[model samples]
Target: MAAFRYFSKKLLSSTLKTDIRAPVSNNYVVCVRLLSYTPMPYDGNPDPGPIFIKKEVQTLLTTLTRVDLAKVYRKRKLGGRQLEQPVYKFMTDEQLQEALDEAKRKVDEILQIPPVVAVRKPRDKVVSRDPALQGLDSSNYIFTDISYGVPDSERIILVRDTEGTLRDADWATRDRINQMYFPVARRQVTPPKMFEDDKLDDLLKRGEYNFILDRACLQFEPNDEFYQKVCSVTYQHINENNKFEDIRSTRHFGSFAFFIAWHKMIDNLLLDLIESEHIDEANALVELYAQLHGEKFRGNSIEEYIGKFSTKKAALELALQAYKNAAKQKHALEEGIKRAHGLN
Candidate 1:
């Protein structure tokens, strides 16, 4: 009664006495704009999905990632279920080894590389228009069926706008409504603030690549826009700042490597590999680079082929020579120590 009385003053007021009228003054304008949304498809890309299926590309990406199981399975906050005390068991050496092997086998499934696919279009499909429902309610209504064993993707979710237009809920609407009706364990109805552009920059500056990727993977599906934007931006930052070390051993590395390769910004990454004296990985990087550029440079040595690189050539060559010098000095030192010991 009080709420209606508050709105009634303006809603029921005479047009002659007041400048404000009900249509524009009583929040009805907001409802009018609710149904005014125009759908626009937002994907601009040449479908890169086919390239990911190649065995050689997959292997190269995996090798570049250099998975560290300890990092992958590292202790981190997992919300409710993660707080439970882990089961400790007294086991024989063989049993422990078997468990270790089993865990190793599951890493691929757990850390499958994030793909660079086209952004999906919006889903604001309308179901019907009923004039009977008009003026029945002032606010929009959401209806969801939350029966047990029904998947969220398969569930029926509907929305009726204030304009009496019945429609299938958009992705954002459906996600919120479903979460409200049937909450998931770790998923939040609202995504974290870290995903916002400014907050994301702050996190990137703080070198929170692993944290961002982990939370993104947990909170959004692989094909979601949030997931794609955060991952892509993070990868670009890592390449630009030479911060690959932050994601080196984590599950996000494979995707990071692929992103770098796809973007044709492999100079810093190649330089890093050479500086770290990871010759095998450097060679593999060259192979992947060649494949991407539609060339086969497998016949030449890494040293021979790397000189032809168009960008940051001086830095890469310098790093390679520095690594070679260090390796030579170390070999010489070992030989001198052998002579000191009077051994061949």
Candidate 2:
């Protein structure tokens, strides 16, 4: 059946071409053997024969013994076949060169154009101070909404010192900074540290907290459940206490400290969920913060990330089974080969 299919393919290829003589059906055996070295569509593999078709007959003759090819050709020709003269005989060297050169030029032309970049420039600014920027604050924080376009968004920190120089506690712009601090503090689920203006400034510089917070606001969480939860938790944590030391002494620290602690808690909580295959829920809980604020996060689509997880699991199992089989067969193969060669 395979031999019949093979001969049929060669017959079809010959018939499809014009200006080329077609092979006779009687030469099926020779044609089938020659076509074995060529890939077939039955294997769903691309035919690579066209790539080597331009090779010089002398070069081909070196790799393949002439007797082998001639035997196949002669047998087919003698089998009462209407012989198709080799196509190479009809094409002069110059004609072949022109064909090859044209193919090369087309390939070169295709490769010359630049590919389009997928990421377009964001049409919005990072921070804006305009009254129109109110609802959009849900998507982005507005520090100064000046109309002049900046190349990239920036986190704005307004600092005004009463003493002018960098003196400890002497700065009167503490109120302005505190205003920003309060909003962030309200967002933290637990007040981990004392709520003091100076501590807030120090925390911002020490932890690089604003960068993390900025992303959290813009993160795309479905139905906004996670965002609402985070906001409410933070608001309660900060407003519930009055004494700064008492709040600082509590199990949860200020916003910066609470953010870190909350992440660890969530990671621990989700481990069992992910392990037990309640991973979709685990993903939902982790996804928003993971995209925006999580430390170990890298950007990945939900499907892509899950696909990688399944693939890795399958691959590991296959590798382990292969390793065991290989180990068991290792010395047995050597012994068998030695005995087969009569050297044992």
Candidate 3:
């Protein structure tokens, strides 16, 4: 029985050995060989003939060879989807010089006119002073009367200094004295007349137009809410006027007040121009004003146009011109003010 068992064990061991040592499939063997193999380095023959190649092309080729395959693929895909093409054409040396020369000529033509001074027209009406009130002495007036009882008589009398004594009185005291002694009727405080669309034609005809220029003063900076409101109103008026063929000029134009007001407006406009870096245009406007006003515009014309130099006085004069032009053009002032305020 033992012998039979021993014989069975020996048979099982022999069978296991045979299974372990059996050959693998042809496909499996091929895959295993590939996985284990190390590729041999290229050992091709050197070039027999000299190769002509540009340095740039060779460098590019070498650079491309070192770049990762993934990166190369990405760059190729992006290149195909390029959004921008160069707009400027290549110019020859002669063509470039010619273009530059033409630009210079145009600039010269623009600045050819010398700046003229703006001369203000003389006033038609002269103010008259009353002879009776001109030489009247205020030295005899009592201290109480002048001060309106703010300072005690004893204290005032002690001080005895009367310089600007009447000027120091409060508004209430002055108003009361004027009411009692002068006996002048008080003027009623009424709101300014609001401009209406219906009344515009009549106002224009009567030369009583109150458009943007009336409100667009230098009292407020360009960024101020009031200035913006003035600009908005002016633009609206200009746009409305465009509908009519024979538009009348603004009522204030050519008037002394208009001249003064427009000059002030120009000061503001020039500031706007400078802030915008439109130095050439600003300088031209200055020259134009100088011509109109007969004022001396300081600074060399060539230097000013090229933005090489500028002066406060010249800038101010230019601004005045800008203002005059704006009033003449109506909407130009509003546009300039808006540009200065960065609203445009």
Candidate 4:
């Protein structure tokens, strides 16, 4: 068929029966399957070119990083509440006093200190009170009002300007401290509904229905792309005339049937020729793809990634394993079909 030989090699090597246990913390089991309705795109379309659409989808799914999640969380306005330190603790005693003095000086220099009273008898012609000096008590001088209270306690100091008005700076430092510790925003716990609806809404709402509606159309299609090539070889020898046909109609069936017989034979030969390369990234790809599929097909929630595969390869293996396991459980999809169709 087209060049799906690569996929068969990769698929078979990876799909051999394996029992991957479900993680203890998780409640979901993941599986993989081809998302296709037909094989038309691959029939005669050899050389699918370098730009395959499914690869683009895989890239988008798996390449999402923490930074991208951060952006999305920011847009959704869902984030952890950042704790704030006390503002009073951030300032030193010198800064507090400097601010207080600057504020007092701007009003009036005399206001910086309390004013003295000029005492005299206005009608006394002899002026018995010494004009050179008033009986001023220097010890009780109001100018030195710093020791009025405890060393760092709050005390009221009033000053009268030439205009005969008073000004007071009362507990301004405490007010500044209060403003600095103003409450931060509260965090919101995003309901599971947002992820469930948003993720599948676009694919279901926007994708063209034609890619999914016609199966027979895919049969005669060229084996030009990666997926199409796999499907072509996978379903070879089966009648392509009808839209609804099971893969068992062909000789290659069961979990290990194709892998053990046909694909393995060709894979070794290809490795001798091409020296193929594979990496751990393949597992990540499978998981991402399965996640998207579970969300799309099973109506699973993002917060509860329970119904999807954790990786692309794992999902595929799960599917193959499921098929084999179903047989071991004395159940097969064909038997289910027979019962449904009244042939059981």
Best by lDDT: 1
**Candidate 2 C-alpha lDDT tens digits along 1-344:** 23344346546666655434445444555554543222111110222122223233122212211122222222321333476785554678998899767765554332221111112222222222344434432332223223344321222333222222222221122223333443333234333342333444354334423222233343312113333233323323222221112222111222322232223223322333344444444444344333323334356433333333322334333443454466569878988999999996
TM-score between model 2 and native = 0.16
Name the weakest run of 10 consecutive residues (lDDT summed) in model 1.
33-42
Order of candidate numbers by TM-score, starting with the best: 1, 3, 2, 4
TM-score of every candidate: 0.73, 0.16, 0.18, 0.14
Cα deviation at 95, candidate 2, in Å, is 92
User: Candidates' lDDT values, in order?
Assistant: 0.74, 0.34, 0.35, 0.29
Cand. 2 Cα-lDDT:
0.34
Residue 223 of candidate 4: its Cα lDDT? 22
Task: Give lDDT: candidate 2, residue 235.
Answer: 27
lDDT string for model 1 (1-344, tens) is 21233244335445426656545444555433332212211143655556665889889888988888887787776555537667999999999999999999988876787665656567878899998888989999988887789998779888899889998888888778877888877788999898887788788778888889888887876656767777877777677668988888667887777666666667778888888889889888888777766666646556665667536666777888899899999999999999999998
For residues 159-229, what per-residue lDDT tens digits would candidate 4 score against the true structure? 33233333332233222222233211221122122213243233323431222212212221122132233
Error of 3 at 105 (Å): 27
Clashing pairs in 1: none
Off by over 4 Å in 3: 1-192, 195-265, 296-344
Candidate 2 vs candidate 4, TM-score winner: 2
